[model samples]
Target: MNVAFDKPSPWQRIQPVFQGFDLPLVFIVAFLCGLGLVNMYSVGFDNGSRFFDQARNMLLAAGVLFLVAQVPPQRLMALAVPVYTVGVLLLVATALFGLTKKGATRWLNLGLVIQPSEVMKIAAPLMLAWWFQRREGQLRPLDFAVACGLLLVPVALVLKQPDLGTSLLVLSSGLYVIFFAGLNWRLILPVLLAGAIGITLIVSYQGDLCQPGVKWVGLHDYQKNRVCTLLDPTTDPLGKGFHIIQGMIAIGSGGVTGKGFMQGTQTHLEFIPERTTDFVFAAYSEEHGLVGNLLLMAGFLALIFRGLVIAAQAPTLFSRLLAGSLSLSFFTYAFVNMGMVSGILPVVGVPLPFISYGGTAMVTLGLALGMLMSIAKSRGLMQR
Candidate 1:
């Protein structure tokens, strides 16, 4: 008797590709991406073929998420050190003979110019998490010191690149790793208090500190300008403040329900700066209004909450720390961008995550989400 079994259909064969995919996380991401595309169409209608290009970028990001999710946490842990080492080496090389544009030496010209700091966004947390996991039960003050040293080296290098946004991100990523790895709140309280006091002092002495020829300590000229502009944008209305002024105007002009999609005067008239990039929140605010803003915030909240849940469920310390850091880092990116656009924080040129148009950033975000998916998937596999 020759009995031939039927081959599994292609759908069945490929179905397992998404077998452990987190449905809620996927929905949240897709929802945010869809909203992003809609807003991009409105903001970039006359900015060339950006909408199509963004569509392509989204596809690319989706592909990255899928491909990366396939890698297990054990494998990711294995790659952490090498990835971080290479990233740091690239940053050092950039410092030596890197490409510079607009006075910022941030890109590496290895045939195709690339920003090494962007890679450190993921690498920093990965390396820190892996380190903490190795010392798991044997963690000591010295171990924490070593971990902070690992983190600061890359962060300082990125800052030397003069990319404050990336520096803030890398800093937060590593901090989250430490925080998750059992850093005591006794230590956290002092830092938070110091930050609060510093802000108070800055606000109190803004007039004196922001005077022409009065140099602010530690901050670069442009960095000082950003803080001063945030304090009082009218001080440099037509110069360094134009972007903030335009952004605030768009956000306020949206009223309660917005001007109705693509109906924003500030957006269509190009009154908003960097409409499709750093100031995307302004364009989105102008077109979508409060209702749209609420929905967008809701999407981000969902993503953040889901990430924490995944971290809570992670089967290993490495997964938990890395997932938590990446998730909170996403929230930080959104909150900082929104705060800057609304004139409450300094304009550090960070994009609005999924809603902004940029291939490189989107790819980074995809890698982040992929890591989260891998954690979720690993949990599922162990359950089975």
Candidate 2:
């Protein structure tokens, strides 16, 4: 009366690890990664191993995403405080004795050079989400104020390092969590209105404000130059304005159907600056045209939509807040990168996600996608 038992085959043993994964999300990421690879071959062929390096970066990121996805939402919540604390401490260390390249002190050497602010991109939102989750049934204005304090600490530190792009990203991540936590619109409208008013004033008086000796309050000289350059690139056609001007030309030359792959004159002629990194969008636009841009935008929109769906179905408050914030964080990255490249926003150090060639940014994106998948998997498990 004994029953025979058989050992599981390799595929059978590994099957459970793949279960509950969000397939739609995986498909979207693969689609974007495919675009990235195609783009690198065209724009980075002569950049000395950029194509292969990007390929390797993608593989590493995939590994990170897979490992992160295995952790449940509860364990993620437990790691939130420690991550945020260490991120803030690293920012402090960066300020005190960090390495500086091209006049910005944003990287620290902890046996390996690292940008601590990137850590805040995820930690800020996680910390805020954790705060709200702790007071889930008893939220108050004071709790939000405490959340703001937690957010602004890292933001101010990063700003002190004169890294406007990273600081804005960190601020937006925390703000998204706060908004999702039911902060009243009455408290948000005034800030938006004031920002609008400030922009109008800057636009109306650019001539006077952009003077050689003009010192804008709360902005570094380089930051002020970027804003002024955005207002009028013609003033410094060969200097500060060269990047925007070249970027616009490449994008405009792409037309409706593009110049075809690797046929981008502007890209091949080296007219586009940072053609594989921050300005990669311009190169992509030139080679792929408006249709390609549309498809790329649609893919990003799908990623955001799926993330929101996962957030809506998450089992806990922390999961919902973190998922929702991370989803919109992708929106922020795409919007800011595209806007800056299109000349609608000032040039910054932000890189286009998945398409841009940067090891650190790719890893950050992987961590975010992994968390989203983890939340999605948790929801599926609960349903059973």
Candidate 3:
């Protein structure tokens, strides 16, 4: 007897793979990518090269998103330690012999000027989540200490590079992992109280303490200047304080309705510093006004909420921790950027997500969202 086996059709062969795709997650990412393209067009109208560069970056990010989406969460857990180790070593190397620009040595020149510290923003959380996943059944205080150590090592090094914005992001991302992994509220309360007291004292005695030659120990001069400028930009209105003052003016001038797209005088006239980067939101606000800002904020809020839902439904501890941390990290990025631009917080050079013109940050965000989609898909698989 001769038997012939039936061949599977292409759709049958790929059905399992296609079923794993998360449409909601894909929609969220595509929306952000579209917004990025729109903002890049407006910001770089005079500079065609920047517009093309942003397009290239977006394509690369889309590739990363697809590649990462294919990765299983279990595999990500296994790779976390190795990725984190390499990222830490890069940070160490950056400290020793990195390229310096504008008084900060945050990038390494290896044929390309790479900011290795950007790696830590994702790696730190991945490493921490993996650690917690390993100790899922029986966690202890020592495990938390180890996780904290994993976070602090890179954070301290990045802060020393004087890129305070990215350092804080990395630190916050790691801390979110720890928090989601059953960190005790009792332990956290004391630290929060201490932070409150410190902020109060700083604001209460700002004049006496922020004087020139007062010898603030840890903070760099530029960092200190940012804090002082936030408190009172009038002190150096035309000097070091110009950025904050101009940003605030642009934001306020928008009133209830924006100046219309490409009609922003502050942005086109070059009144705003870093219009395509850290202060992109201010430029956006100038053009779109209050209604535009509200729309932008709503989109961010929806994205964060969707991410949280994905985290809650994640199949494993690693997925949950990574998804939760990444979501909160996104929130921190928006908060810091908007806060600084609105003159409510210090200018720490944090980029506005999906709005700012930067390649590294765009790639980082793509990787993060991809991980979330991976987790979400895994959760659906487990449910089925």
Candidate closest to the true structure, highest lDDT? 2
lDDT of 2 at 133: 96
How many collisions per candidate?
0, 0, 0
Residues 221-242, model 2: lDDT tens digits: 8999999999999999999999
Off by over 4 Å in 2: none
- Model 2 pairs whose backbones collide: none
- Identify the candidate with maximal TM-score: 2
| Candidate 1: residue 160 lDDT (0-100) | 92
After superposing candidate 3, which stretches have Cα over 4 Å from the reference?
Answer: 1-16
Against the true structure, candidate 3 has what lDDT? 0.89
* Model 1 alpha-carbon drift over 4 Å, by segment: 1-3
lDDT of 3 by residue, 254-348 (tens): 88889988888998999998988899888888888999888888888888999999998888889999999999998999999999999999999
> 1 or 2: which has the higher lDDT?
2
User: For each candidate, C-alpha RMSD in Å?
Assistant: 1.1, 0.9, 1.6
Evaluate all candidate structures by whole-model CA lDDT and list the values in order: 0.94, 0.95, 0.89
- Rank order (by lDDT, best first): 2, 1, 3
